[model samples]
Target: MEQDVSLGLAIFVEHGREREAADFYGSAFGARQFQAHHIDGALAGVEMRLGATVIAVAGANPRREAEPSRGGPFFPKVAGGVSTIIQLTVPDIDGCFAQAIAAGATLRDEVQTDVAGRRVASLFDPFGHIWVLIERDASAGRRAA
Candidate 1:
């Protein structure tokens, strides 16, 4: 059975880094590519699944820059300035963090327990998107019990 589309993210990667972003997501987050969109034999976009969530990855829209007033979406021009941050609740933060680093993610913050009792870390993929990896603190539940 196919899942109905609800909320999905469309990330416009930096110019010529579309494939790299897709690969990083696959290795670091266990995402699976289900579809690839092409234009005149060149890769245009990709659709991938991270668990049940779907994400669309594409190259920067040059048209948007030429038509500034026709604003929609465009590749991030500056690091640490991207408007959206992807948050993933994982079963193993340490393992996922290691995988992300190994896959070329730049560490923004080391894993640490937040005030809410969740272990969280942040990293930037090669393409400039910020990803927050989170793991619920098991000890908090044990303490409550």
Candidate 2:
């Protein structure tokens, strides 16, 4: 079998309520609920479509417990390293920023212009994931081309 080079991105969260967390992400990103399955008295998995990307959510399998003394070294105490940030390229950075803030995300930075002449803003979701929204001016594309 040929090895697949592309792998889907998943953010493993220690969620106290899986359904709520999934719904929050879905609403925040304007994503549709692709799939949600429950099994053996726990949330088995869920998939949400963010633009063309699919994000999977799964309950922490208690059966695969790690040693109590083996603390996570790479991950931050508040936000895990695995989920550094997710960037969303949109047509309206300001609009998306307003929507995300209204949906419960804290504003990390105000919309600012970059050297590339794109407007961008950074925000943090309730789940501790950072999201950077970028809006590239249409004229910039023409100049580049």
Candidate 3:
């Protein structure tokens, strides 16, 4: 038998913007920041609470930004240098997506209903963080996503 382990997701934002990212997520998810870490008096990371889920945000690090052999600023060649996709379940899909847009998020896709009967939408925050709003039909005896 294999041992099971819990996994946590972490996202890195550009340097000097960890706090902004965390706050943006807080507003978008209607959550709050419960912890934060700093390096040399500058915010290096933050952990936000969304109900029972916690997501970590890390500050930009040149060492991890681009090709090490190519040297610093590891920014991606195109948009969204990151690889993490954050999905959030909200009571109202439209309302939550609108709130995110009002908070400076760029709409990437409008809400669409899938065959599974779930409403989903995508957007990018100012820092280029990707997010998806999910609204599952719990009343259909389904659980939240």
Candidate 4:
């Protein structure tokens, strides 16, 4: 049985950097990478599976110097700040956070845990993206927001 409609999220960055970002995510989250789309000898879109969730990465827009130009490479002309975020849940939040930092992510805030047993973190990736990582407590079913 297949559903008629499905929802998905895809993040587009610099043209040439799409594959790079996908690689980073694969390494960071221990996900398997499957090529979804490619353009100009590079990955334009990729699918990464972290556990049961699928995350997508794609090139925003690429303008070849030879191929009739379309503005100044990339589209929408995003500002310096990021507006969207990719949320993740991992077994080891600290370890994942450290690995992300080592892989060029800036710490957006200190890891905070409320007395109710909720531990979470926010970070900005070097590749023009943001992420919120949370750790699940094995003993507890849910943590307070």
RMSD of each: 3.4, 3.9, 3.6, 5.1
lDDT of 2: 0.70
Global Cα lDDT for candidate 4? 0.71
Q: Which residue runs of candidate 1 sit more than 4 Å off their true CA positions?
A: 1-5, 137-145
Please give the range of 10 consecutive residues that has the lowest summed lDDT in model 2.
72-81
Greater TM-score among 1 and 4 belongs to 1
CA lDDT of every candidate: 0.86, 0.70, 0.76, 0.71
Candidate 1 lDDT (Cα, 0 to 1): 0.86
Ranking by TM-score: 1, 3, 2, 4
Which residue segments of model 3 deviate by more than 4 Å?
1-5, 66-78, 142-145
Candidate 3 lDDT trough over 10 residues, lowest sum:
71-80
Candidate 1 TM-score versus the reference: 0.87
Compared with the true structure, what per-residue lDDT tens digits does model 2 show for residues 1-145?
Answer: 3564544666555534567668777777687778887886668668888877788865554444354355432222353234467888888887888888888888788999978777988987776677889985777689999
lDDT of residue 31 for candidate 4:
67
Q: What is candidate 1's lDDT per residue for 10-129, written digit by digit as tens?
A: 888875677888988899889999999988888888999998889998887778767879995777666666888989988899999999999888999999998987889999887778
Q: Model 3 clash pairs? A: 65-74, 66-74
**Each prediction's TM-score against the native?**
0.87, 0.76, 0.80, 0.73
Q: After superposition, how far is residue 18 of candidate 1 from its true place, in Å?
A: 1.5
For candidate 4, lDDT tens digit of each residue in 37-144? 766565678987777767777776544423535443332233225556788888889999998888777788768995667799888776756788889786665554
